[model samples]
Target: MGLFTDAYDLFCIPPIMRLIGRVYYGDVDDPKKRYQVPIAITSAMVAIALLGAVIGQLVFGHLGDRMGRRRVLAWCGNWRDYPLSATIMSEFANRRTRGGFIAAVFSMQGFGILASSTVTMAICAIFDAASHSSYEKTPKDADWAWRLILLIGSIPAGLTFYWRMKMPETARYTALVEHNVLQAVNDVRNVLDLPLRNEELPPYPSPLDYPFFSRAFFRRHGRDLFSSAISWFLVDVVFYSTTLVLSQLNDQYLPKKENMNAYQDAYNVARFQALLAICSTIPGYFATVLFIDHIGRVKIQIMGFFFMAIALFAMGIPYFSYWYDHSDRGFLFLYGFTFFFSNFGPNTTTFIVPAELFPARFRSTCHGISGAFGKIGAIVGSIGFYWASQQNEENDHSNAKRITAGLVILGGACIVGVIMTRLFTHETMGRSLDDNENDHVA
Candidate 1:
């Protein structure tokens, strides 16, 4: 539910922008006001939330390590969803199916996105029905609609807070960070519904031994940290930017909703986004859940990057000719494949790898850093794509070149991601969490 709310809040923003513009802002159709809407919406509504996310990830990550995953993961009551979920799942997961387990948890994001789209469409429908009027072209009467939708996001998050408080800390965290091996084993026994092993083990290492940012920490796991953060940053730059700019690309194929009322326009846009989620986005997540363990994170990510690059190139390069055709489905196939590969590929692997790659002492912290970096990429992509498009309009350059360049840049990002994976990232498939951590204990 935490990750679900995360995806819901992020995606719900785009469809409601028109409602916001018509109700809260003025004259978005004006050349003077045109650029203002996306920028203001992106900054105030979208970018600011993501910025908060970066800070939240870092702060909560640190605390999760210090206080315990269950104790600190209480954010939303304590942290963002990824690190906590990944950490708990990784620690608990069996070696053989760990990737699939983690990926399955992450897969809820697809349904979350689908929920966001469905809810957006339904809300618009309700408002249209209640008002007994098509949404006005320059809407002023329906200001309540957006506020209601935004508030609805809080409901699920609130419900999940109780469950989070009830959940137990992972055995790995209890044993390793807190240096309470007996308690750790007890926790594990309860979680797995198993009898405790009677075999004795060595004395617990002091928490002081694995101090973050110490010399030993750097030597043991610095490379993995760098790879996780940088690769995530690269993946998100393209992902966020492409998402924000996709409408422009789709605008070529989809006829502009001229003469339509605000509700009509919003509904169509909301419905379109929902279709994409249902048809491509959600399915891609399931693919990751199904195959990530078998293919290996490294291979899946590599394939995702290559295909994303090819699809972006196809979309961008053909923008002027074949891609822009009035009735062709070619661009959509390419576009949908990019979305597919992204979720099934880097998006899932990056999140999973960070949680699994590092020792428990630094696990959440490293994952937080990587997740934060991805947000940085998202901010860059969103602003950059918008600015590039605005520049194209102002300079009288063709829209095709604008799309082509933007997608090409994203493709280049995917290429960089592929290199990072090959050179830096260690595959996490079929390895026990204990095995992964031992590499950092030297």
Candidate 2:
């Protein structure tokens, strides 16, 4: 649910940005500047949440490790719950199902994206009906539409707060990190609803208490940490760049500016986003859930990155001139595949691997560290791409060419992801958390 809220809040902004522009920056005298929100303002509005996320991930991640996952999770706000969710899922799930479990939790992001688009579309439709005036003629109606969409994001966050508080501390954290054998056994017994056995339980393994920055810890997990962080960073660069720029892409596919009013423009953009999520994003997440365990994280991530690169390059390279001159449908098809492979590949795997590869004591912290890097990538992608897109427009570059440049850069990032995944990551499939944690000890 937290992940759901995260996606909703983050994604709902793009469609409404034009509405925001119409409300504040609309210029009736100049057609080109009419609905254009300044690039600086647009970038700031989109990147602010992601900037906050980087800080929140680091702070909450460390808190989850030091204080306890359940306590930290309950105390932290919903938007920063990614690392905590990954850690808790990793600790609780069995080895055979761990990848799917964690991936399943993250998959809520797809629904969140879908919901944001759907809700925005509904709100725009409602306002369009109520105002009985085109937004271009009376921009005030757009004000209400964007606000209602943003407010709806808070609902899921509020609904999940109590459940977060009620969640039990993971047994792995209690047993391995806290070294509380009896409490851990009881936690497992209660969760499983199993009869308590009279037989003695095995002694808990001695804690590997290396500090996160210590040489011992670095030697054990340095490669995995670097792998996870860098992989996440690269994927997010492409993921967010493509996502936040969809409005610009939609503009190309949409009918001519003279043909539609502002309300119709906003509605169509939201509708297109919803369609993309339904056709590509949601299916990709579920595909990961189905295949992640069978395929292994490393293989899936490498495959995802590789294909994402292929799809992106197809849209950007040899076909760039063709796309610029030709069918929007052909371009959108390849574009959709990038989202598909991202979910089925590195995006899901990066989140899962960090949670599993680290020791119980440092799991949340490492995941947090990794997630922070991803957010940094998001910030770069959102702000950087918007700036680039604006620059292209200023230079009289066609929207197609601007989008092509961004796609090519994103493709390069995916290629780098492939290399990094191949070099730095390890397969965690069917391996116990304890086995992964202790494998680097010697």
Candidate 3:
């Protein structure tokens, strides 16, 4: 389900961004109205997704405890079946090279969208720039191009169909939930290619008595949820805030005055952003693969967030200074760092950790719960950026003030994330499920 969800969402991105841009700026030529609409819709959609995810986490999470993990995961696959094709591609390699391969899959998702968005936005640019003399051909040609891009982009999602039909449920999930110690043992043996003994089977929790609300369960899981939620919140807030501000900054300060058509300008800006995202995200994943194990998740998260804080501040200085003596180059550097570190930073772990840490019964719920908070943070960041930008534009105040506020808030949130991760999350590297806290190995 995790694999499927990741892949499906990746392909859906270009359309999502296109829809967002449409809502945010019906016509990108107008800066004042540009971000407001898109951010507003973004806020709404995220709010809804967050709400549904939280309730789903609570309900489905509890159900996972009552039902078997395998059953619950299978059910979740209804929404989770999008990434199998990519996951299968990653699964064949040996362990040493697997991370690189899987990271490539993750990275390719960005590249796919970058390519799609680039072409889509290019069409928009061409249409927007067309003269009245070209008016008769403009609409038809632009529509054809957009339809073609959509058709091509949809291919990746279609590719997952075959794999989705054949993938088996995780054997570990079956073992833990069904309490069939012998079957569980055999399942693990099959995957690991080792012999199994009944004596070696793990002890199972009492499925008859669901323990979701019990003090023991809360004691073990509550702190994790809080920590995951807060960390996700911080990541989303800072990440989206910086990304959006930087996008707007590009056009505002670095206006390609040579290009005067509004649609053309927006298309170029979007294409530029798509390229930047691909460039930064691919490298970021490699950095994660290389350093995540070596530095440890705790250190990687802290370093990533802190580095982002520094970059945010660096960008904010000039923003707050009213571009006092320089151009938007300083701001662009900050934006670039934000994009780079985002994929390279806690963003990766934040998503992966929630899935890895929790018990199988609650994995999706916890992931969804934490993911919900992340969405809230994304909404806040989007709305906040729009509000600040609007205020700055309306009152003729220095863009610096809003940029400073955004950066300061993000820095503080990063500091909080570092603290939560250090205090709450246990070291999971190479640790068996039986060894982790709550001891659900059985």
Which 10-residue window of candidate 1 scores lowest in summed lDDT? 198-207
Compared with the true structure, what per-residue lDDT tens digits does model 3 show for residues 1-442? 2443343333333333543444334446766554234555555664564455445544554454456444444444322321222223222334344444444545554565466556667566556556443222223343344455456544545554454434444554565555566666666677678887878865755442345567766777788878778888889888766654445555565444333333444455556656666667557766877765556656677777878877766666555565534674655666777767776777766655565566655555566667667757866775677567645455445655766676667777777777777887655444434344246433
Clashes, model 1: 3
Clash totals for all candidate models: 3, 0, 6
Candidate 1 TM-score to native: 0.93
Which stretches of model 1 miss by more than 4 angstroms?
25-41, 77-79, 138-141, 197-210, 252-255, 325-327, 392-396
> How many backbone overlaps does candidate 2 show?
0
Better of 1 and 2 by TM-score: 2
lDDT of 1 by residue, 1-442 (tens): 7778888887777767867665655555665454135564555565787788889888787777878888876654322767888888888888888888888888777777788878877887787767765535655545777777778888888888888888878877888888788887777777778787835433444444657868887787888899999888988888887776686456545445455555666677677777888888888898998898888999999998889999988887767566655447877787788889999899888989999898888898889888989888888887778777666455434755776778888999999999999999988888877776665555
RMSD of each: 2.5, 1.9, 5.3
Instruction: Provide the global lDDT of candidate 1 against the true structure.
Output: 0.77
Number of the top TM-score candidate: 2
Which scores better on TM-score, 1 or 3? Answer: 1
- Residue 322 of model 2, lDDT score: 78
Full-model lDDT, candidate 2: 0.83
TM-score of each: 0.93, 0.95, 0.75
Q: Ten residues in a row with the worst lDDT in model 2?
A: 196-205
Query: lDDT: which candidate is best?
Result: 2
